[model samples]
Target chain A: MKTWTIKLIVGGCFILALVVTVTSFFCNDDFWKVNAAQALTLILTICIAFWATQLKNDVRKKKEHAEQILKKIQAIVNNDGFYYVSAESDAIETQKRMTMTFRSLNNSIDLLKKYGQELGFKVNAEYIEKEFKDYRDFVSEHITDVDYLSRSESTLRKHSENIDNKCDIIIWGLY
Target chain B: MIVINISKDFTDTPGARYKSEGEYSGELFRETILIPKYVEAIASKSQLKVELDGGYGYATSFLEESFGGLAREYDIQEVLRTLVFESNDEPGLINEITEYIKMARRERK
Candidate 1:
């Protein structure tokens, strides 16, 4: 049973006990009986109040626990790869889905590396440098064309500036 | 009708393994192609027929489903007889297949 249900049952029993004691005292004309009844009722009242306080504390603790779990999941998502955060009491379907997604991501990353290798082109600094050189040559050739240069001076200037920036980046990397 | 005969020796590329891991593990590289409307229509029309070379059929089914195009799996002997044999060693065949796929996709669209 849930924690709340257990608390309710225990509280009900304490109240019942208090009621019976008080009723028995009224029925009898004994002084001890009345005093005992009063003492029992006071004890039961205190027990009920204590139970209420515990229930409140339990609710607060649960809320804090859930928030902490959420923060952990968020941290994982941001730092690590995408994955499902399974709760202790998560349904079977939820666990299955999380597993599937994780597997899929793992496979994709693996395949990407394989494809890069298969294509003789290395996706690294050497490839980037070759591409930059080709781009620079293309821009220089276009800029040197008298008709093209005359017609679009601003555009040519922009292209040359971009090539210069790329050269600068390459030089910075080398150093 | 352009028929592509992929050899059994062709294994799933690392990329292919990742994308369709649980679902498919075939040699057909659908990721490299850019097919539009017609490809989708062809896939939708193609019925999945399983045979001894059922792996090809499964891969075709996956592509058909993904691209929304038609795909028909044939026996190795039947494929060899009907389709023009393109040497796997030829780099041009890749381009040809890409072009044919694009053309078929366009026509279907």
Candidate 2:
């Protein structure tokens, strides 16, 4: 089973052991020794549970961070044309990687946008970028890309003409 | 799979050279071009071949790393055909690559 499950099991066992020790002390006349053992076991159990919970939280935070990084990378690779850096940036290596990935994504978007314009494809970069940014902002609060993208797309479509040029400029600026 | 051979000479153009020699040489051209292109091609149900001219120097290192990163992310093996000589600047290189692509397409058929 999972490590967390194992920890929980072990922690439960310690609590059980403490309960048994206390009960045995109350039943038999060995008041001092059994009570001491029960007290120690109870403290150890609490400590173990606290540590296990901390470890689980740490693991969860790490997984969330990794997923966030992957999402940013995937967004760049998927030709979304925007890179959103967390307000709290990390180390030099992370910054370098993020910058490089953003630059690359930016270039690709520029190339595609240029190609679309040349081909007379009705893709407004500014509109798309704004919608994407707004969606990203929404997701920052809501944490859902699909919902954000859908809502932004609908909103952009509703106000397309006025924001067409604006959206194109925003996408170009992202690079 | 559509494999596009990217030679060091392809990145020797003034724009590419400037970008490479700039403060972000670690960023590399392949990371900028080949990796995204490969990902795009794959997502669109196409194969990409990145033909390398040689397996040495800064250009090679960048290409290798970029290819490895893409491969790892995609979880699919990629082909990196190393040419004995660097020839991206040569006019015939494009033609040679076009032929290779054509042959691969035919094999797929």
Candidate 2: misplaced stretches above 4 Å? A1-34, A80-175, B1-15, B18-109
Model 1: CAPRI class: incorrect
Tens digits of per-residue lDDT for model 2 on A1-175? Answer: 6989999998999999899989988897756655778899989999999999999887566444433433343454344322333334342332334324423433343444454453333355434445433432333222212233334544433333333444334334332
For residue A112, give model 2's deviation from the true position in Å: 27
Compared with the true structure, what per-residue lDDT tens digits does model 1 show for residues A112-142?
2343343322243233334333432332232
Let me know the TM-score candidate 2 reaches against the reference structure: 0.25
Fraction of native contacts under 8 Å reproduced by each candidate:
0.00, 0.00
lDDT (0-100) at residue A147 of candidate 2? 34
- Residue A22, candidate 1: Cα error in Å is 26
lDDT of 2: 0.42
Q: What is the lDDT of residue B6 in candidate 1?
A: 32
Q: How many residue pairs in model 2 have overlapping backbones?
A: 14
- Per-model TM-score of chain B: 0.24, 0.41
The candidate maximizing DockQ is 2
